[model samples]
Target: MLKVLIVDDDKNSREVIKLALERIYEVEVALNGVHALELMKKNSYDVVICDYVMNEVDGIEVLKKMRKSGNNAVFILITAFGSSDTAIKAIQEGAFEYLSKPFKMSKLKQILAEIEKSLSEKKKEEAVETNKDFEDEQIIADSPVFLEVLKQMARIASSDVPVLITGESGVGKEVVAKSIHKYSKRKKGPFVAVNCNAIPPSLLESELFGYEKGAFTGADKSKPGYFEQAQKGTLFLDEIGDLEFDLQVKLLRVLQENCVRRVGGMKDIKLDVRYIFATNVDLEQKVAEGKFRADLYYRLKVAEIRVPPLRERTEDIIPLANYFIKKYNFYNREIRLSQGAERLLLKYRFPGNVRELENIIRASLIKARYTGVIMPGDLGLKEEHIKELNREEILDALKKAGNNRKKAAEILGISRATFYRLLKKFSIE
Candidate 1:
């Protein structure tokens, strides 16, 4: 069941929200930020609803305090202050959603629904693997480039320095990050990953720092952010290049001070965490272009590892393909890839890298079904799907050549060997 923490000074308001949400959530409540923090330290909650106004601590202060502590629960702020600036500030602090006083119960329900969706997505991503499942002494070397990267990873994993992994999209950066955490001394703690690009800039800060109850318009309770959740563990920041400029400064401060302040709270919470960040973009170029900060780059790149693209590490193609084939075969309880299918996969250049290779193998498995041999046709690689071929021109040429393989191959500017491959690809023969 989803857990919700409610913080409101008014007894009536707290009870109303608790009753309404209890049907769908396991609800907890606190009269103020201090009590909320005490409760948070003892238990983990999924969502927090905080009121914006209180005598001792306001909603923003609560958020600031939560962030400093590094808790990352979803926070929704409720306030009577309906100004645009307040809303923007609340969102910037990481309130999942803001609600005004005297709002309809239906609106609150809708926000909860969104939270459920977000939680579901998070669970799906987390289901990939656990830290224990990662092999500490595993040598992932199907290619020279990967071998070099593994060597570097070993050196970096031995220390407590921050590491920034740069690579193309879908190149297994997360897998690499997990491997680092698994090899590190802090392997026993939680490994939390936050996708900076996936969350909006307005909510990114609060999501990272956390918020106090009654900090803004719709904060019903206090909550923690990633920094707190990853205490004595590794925090993987994916797509670090996409972080907003203002948040970047705050993050730099946290890294430098080794502490965080929640969105509306007054105290700083010390943290011991290993920061592992990954980005597909060129951070140096981004810094030069003023899109990324130079100082922050230096701090994060104290250790750097770059993952080679699939095309650059072509030697790994067959191994990776077969690995995926075997992996999916177990999951799907299906036949293995045939020799012909493996050859076809070897010829393709996967722009999407390892992720693309995994998907291809999965698709082939489905097409092969319970059949023991996965054929090249099961991959569904159409002639036009092959790179360097425009659909219209290829169709026109095929018509002009009267569908003759040799002539069409000539007009298409590819060798007959390649043409035969295309014929088998399109199932023309």
Candidate 2:
């Protein structure tokens, strides 16, 4: 629901406005500009309504202070004495809509409706702009490993090749996929991404191939899947190694034929999508273990790109850290990582890779909001964090188990003796 703040010293005026707007919005009341500012600091409001003839801080003064403080909420000044000059000034100073006192409820409702529609359109525009910014960033990398990957991506992005991206988890493979789509001839079209590891095998196929109306139980309506949505664009398949064997064959057929037949439907749909598959597993090893199909692996590896883990690219740490600090500084006005914090970040071997670095930076920024400068203590990385996992096997187990070691070993589908030996080797209790 839209929230509105009403600032008027006159109790009757506040009550009248509240009565009219309460059913439509979440209404908040403040007697003066000072009280309104305090409420704004603690929460966000969609619109602010203030009386023009207040004693200390008038409506114009309140609007000026709000603008100076970077408050983007829409403002509507209520004045008993309305003038063309005053309305012009309000518009120039970023007041969204101006209202004269003793106005009809219908007019107020109409104005509120217009403001809501405008805000909705603005939000949609902002979302598009933010996605464009992510495209611009494109996961900055110049390391030898990334450069080689970029070269491969550039080569395949222009073609209709089924390119597969192999890398460790959180190594920015999705970013690489997006970069390929952005630079490709399909840049004008949509780029769709789906996590194969996240969805179950039963749902994964439906998600990819889409479904016709009444295709299956709970399949209420006809829907276009990733392939249909990504027509003339790029379809990014993240964690492709996790796809079940049956779905693998179906996916392989779709890649080979450039057509897909939805589940419970006989008709085939031709797709003109560039496939960009990503996996954090060794496909060859998985094939040898009978977990992944060799034929499917070969097809996806027609064009390959591997993103190096964070530990392998230590040189990018400080630069990436500073980048995140500056990026987050927009939201948090006062935040900077100290030299000690930077050193601590660099020294740690980030097994969780770029994602972990981002989380650490976000956590530090929150800490900095309260303490001014982000220090080592703000990072929350002490001896306990170090002791948790200092060995590769234990760390690998933790990741496989979703950071739960005992469950990881249980599903290792590994023998107890071997699991204990591995744990001991890793000094994991």
Candidate 3:
């Protein structure tokens, strides 16, 4: 469970919040900001909810002190006496969220839920980064279709040529890129991965190409961008198809010239970097449509690898699901899929691919924590595909529901109307 520290001078406010959140979180309350800071010295908290007004030290001061101490807890500032400027200042100072006092408990719960998900995702990413041995062992390539892609990756790993990986979202393009980097001679150096579309276009140029001091309004000090940081290594630019047209030209120049000039620098900084780009978009179509530069497309596509979608590579689904189950085994539960659950997963078309499978497995584990065996219903395949359940399955559901149609529909993970249709199709009274 996540630990949360609530800092408020008012005893009623503190007790109310503690009562509301203690069930979901390991919560502790502080009498004031000063008390909160003292508690912080003894224990780490995932989140801090602090009232902006208090004696000895205010919430803003506590936040600054915590940040200065290298605490990365999500700080939520609440103030009954706050102006727009104060809210802005709190946010600018790195508070995760700022809200006025008298905020609804539901709203706070919603924010906390969002924070939980965000933190969970961050932890997953960090785990992937730090656990290389586990990752190498768990690479899902059971299907011949995907194995061929791996063979191609092996062929290209030693080569310095640019690589373009094309596939749908969540098709593991970045994973392939990382494998290439790991096997390459440049593996000793950095493997800097960046999503070209994730960063705002306005700031992306400086982020990719670095900047000199005094280059822009906030250029307080010279900073090396992604390209410079990836010197003597591979730079994986994911979603390169979504890159702004203007940056395409700059990137082409860098590839051709083998150097980069900081935003306000005079001299070009030469780099020995390999480039691997991935995109779900069809660059050929973009080129024909004049949205992408043909020259840049050709430059990036020295070797192209297209990863097949998950539905096409169904052979790897169960293995990948099991890998995710192990990856997110938070409670160390010996969770396994029931026969019905395995069949359901194999039959369903995973539109979101491997990522979706992982999410389903993680959630199913939560639902199956006590039983240690995931069932079909726990898998949460309540889509149109649930209709794939045959007459026998429908009859079983009806028996489970004691012949109540509505309850049977619920058991079958379908609407009552759809259940009626299924019953008619099967000639069941």
Candidate 4:
């Protein structure tokens, strides 16, 4: 069942919707938009049915904030004070549906059924989604070099050998680790992950090896550490280069012996975990500098896989941008990247790699809510070619292109989506 939230200031109205939807959906009710937004931060709702009129923090303000912050749930606005202007503003602000107060229960159910059916069909389509516009997979690229990396990863996923994944930050090292576990014989086993740099060094040992009851002041009960937690599965150790020199010896021993001794415990426990290590730094250099253990470095490098930075694979940029566009695009109109937008995206050197590219596209999508077109301005980019284009110039360019979308975009120095947006803005069609 899809999760739904109903926000209304009137208690009776809230109960009416809540009672109507609770059996069909995982329904939640909030007294007003502020309470609804606070709950939004903690839960992912499939649909938000909000009242347009409220004492404070009205639904429109909540909707704008939600879109700005990347919440892509379907929003249905209901108001007793409905008018053509209210409906138009709702559509412009990305409301999926609008309802007038005192509407029939059957109408609401019909809308709910439609939402459910659409979501079910999309879920079916995505059961085997791959290499399309979706970006849930950490590594989604068509570059020849990246394809070779995938081939290598697929081949290496079957073995129990220790794997070292090296790459620049945001190059998706952890994603590679998860893929290894997903294809291995231990695919059904748990996959545990940790960042060596994230946890403080003082607490890292107890966290890794676990501890017995009363092992420390706060150790009231026995707990299995990351090792035991990952038993019979994969354990991804991210940023392994940040491991303290002292703890490196213990980690090496566990790798060598396949056993661990819990803190304050006398007996050693055998472990069956497959180790996958990732780092953005040079482990060899760290060893040479006497900051990291040379033995551990060599041990982790038994099977090494290196990922190239995003800038190195220029061909993947457009596909990646389109992927993010599909991910965060929620407007009624279809959004597309202009040739100009693509050129500018390709021209920039993404110092933060794929993560930065994702951020840029997500932000652009939010900015393109009204236009349904990602412009250079959405990406904070500037180009001289189209700086002087005006409404008449754009209309004249469209007329010159014989109303062809691609040619019109070329003439106006914008993307096809932008051309369509301009047509709507001018009421041309």
Best candidate, TM-score-wise?
3
- For lDDT, the strongest prediction is 3
Superposed on all Cα atoms, model 2 deviates from the true structure by an RMSD in Å of 17.0
Which residue pairs come into collision in candidate 2? Answer: none
Please give the TM-score that candidate 2 achieves against the real structure.
0.59
Show where candidate 1 strays beyond 4 Å. Answer: 1-140, 330-334, 382-429
Candidate 4, residues 277-325, lDDT tens digits: the string is 9999998899899999888888999999999998788889888888777
For model 1, how does the per-residue alpha-carbon lDDT over 149-180 read when each residue is reduced to its tens digit? 98898898889999999999988899899999
* Candidate 4: clashing pairs of residues: none
Ranking of candidates on lDDT, top first: 3, 4, 1, 2
Error of model 3, residue 327, in angstroms: 0.2
Query: Residue 29 CA error for candidate 2 (Å)?
Result: 31
Clashes of each: 52, 0, 0, 0
lDDT of each: 0.78, 0.76, 0.84, 0.81
The sequence of per-residue lDDT tens digits that candidate 2 reaches over residues 119-156 is 44334332211222432344656566666677887787
Q: Which one wins by lDDT: 2 or 4?
A: 4
